[model samples]
Target: MSQVFEGYERQYCELSAILTKKCNSATILDGEQKKQKLSEIKAGLDDAEALIRKMDLEARSLPPNVKATLLAKLREYKSDLNNLKTEVKRITSGNVNQAARDELLESGMADANMVSADQRQRLMMSTERLNRSSDRIRDSRKTMLETEDLGVSILQDLHQQRQSLLHAHDTLHGVDDNISRSKKILTTMSRRMSRNKWIIGTIIVVLVLAILLVLYFKLAH
Candidate 1:
């Protein structure tokens, strides 16, 4: 990811957590407190939305072929943003949320001193859950990065092995040529040795005949 996009994403993540807290805690919505809280959530939502726009800008700035993948991720983020928007809308309006709003307005009565103890506790628990979820997300991202690096290393090793195999193949091709040449040389030498043997046998036969004729002339005398 580009540094700009990463920055935008970091901001978005923080805002997302904040919005989650406000929207979830406001289950009982009412009065000035609920209105003020919703306004803050809306503000955060707007900022998150602006960041999403920036991220989209950054993503689209990439080359066409590369942008496709990032765009898909951006689409998912947009979906998430829409869900957050919907949740806030649902909490702030309609008959379903009207009573809860009244309850929250009443809770403010116990304020400045006590009564929000449970509310605070619930907020704490929500924060903890969000933190744990963030941790798991970070761990998953780390594992993915490690896996990608391992895959690259394996590809490099495979390429080197392929090159070595090609070199060995070339060497074997040369050896086959040498073997053929050696076979021809041996065949030529065998033919010459056979011809030389025949000439020696002819000379031996001629000498023996001349000796036999001389012996016969001596006996006649």
Candidate 2:
């Protein structure tokens, strides 16, 4: 991967640190200040998400041999990012609930019907906000599930390839054993042919000597 991809990991860490600090101190800040800090946290989270996506793409572009390990690490970072986002959402939701409570408490002997209408409006707005946040969470969850499925499929392919390699290795070993057996059989046949040649030569020499003795006897007579 390029250095830009590597730098993204570090950048995410820095952004996460800043967001964590902001979240920790958010409760102590005044309402306006808390809203501003939440805005910054949301921006930082967006940057973190961008960095995560870049890292994932870079890791996936690596060769398969090394890609698995890098992808595992990337998944861990993604999980961390999910946790951070969840925390930020929780803080934002808590603020909404707190504001609703403060508004209810401050209404002080106001006209009952008007108070009811105002509270209902605020409740409707909060509900809409929650629904929007839920939709985003659902989308994120769906993407994560798809990524996990892809990883599982890759692992299965690698396993099948490993099984094929092992089967091929066994077949080559069997062929080598067959070759060795054929070599031994040919060696034994070659030795038997050599013995038969030596026996034939001995018989011919003996016959020639016998004929020579018979000729000598005829000449003497």
Candidate 3:
């Protein structure tokens, strides 16, 4: 019984160590990090399988209590493995590339043994942090895009305003030219009328003077 317990403890330690490494790898989502974690997980899983096999063999040689304990442990490992598979499915559901999927699968299986309550709590915290960071990055990118759109809209408005001002300036210039031309025509007509009036006044004074001279000569005769 003591020997069986020792083996179980060793198996638990090995599985826990591998799982810790896998969770750490998940913290790094880069290609190289994923690949390295995948390799480590595969190796760890192999070791775990070997330990389980040894435990199985020892089960047959142990007392009833030890046998029952080993069987229960086996079931726990199976349950952990199933959960690992499901986690892999979730991680790779976002149209991830083949290499990324492979790496996520490897890291997800690194800890396929029953975990302690403390370890579960830590894992949950880590997952939450990662999700929050991803959301923040997405929001920042969206704000930048909106700012760019606003800048483009303002630029278009300025361009239209500049065109309007230029058109107004051109129209005012044409009106000024027309007014100046009309003023010159009006001045020329006024000067011509003044000269005509002077010529007509001189002709009327000459005719009246001639009529007075003829009447005076006839009366004297």
Tell me the spans in candidate 3 whose CA falls farther than 4 Å from its real position. Answer: 1-124
lDDT of 2 by residue, 1-221 (tens): 34555587668666766666666556445578879988988888888888888888886887663455456556756766786687678667765465644553465213333533454455345435644655676688799999999999999999999999999999999999999999999999999999989999999999999999999999999
Model 2: worst 10 consecutive residues (lDDT sum): 108-117
The sequence of per-residue lDDT tens digits that candidate 3 reaches over residues 1-221 is 34664566466555855565564445346567766666666566667666666767776677664466556555655555555545444443435666754664676344332344445555445435644654676588789999999999999999999999999999999999999999999999999999989999988899888999999999999
C-alpha lDDT of all candidate models, in order: 0.73, 0.71, 0.63
Listed in order, each prediction's TM-score against the native is: 0.47, 0.42, 0.45
Clashes of 2: 0
Candidates 1 and 2 compared by TM-score, better number: 1
lDDT of each residue in 18-108, candidate 1, tens digit only: 7776775666655788888899999988998999999999979976644555576567567668877987887776555556556656763
Q: Where is model 2 more than 4 Å wrong at Cα?
A: 1-122
Q: What's each prediction's clash count?
A: 3, 0, 0
Candidate 1 to truth, TM: 0.47
After best superposition, candidate 1 residue 188: deviation in angstroms?
1.4
Best by lDDT: 1
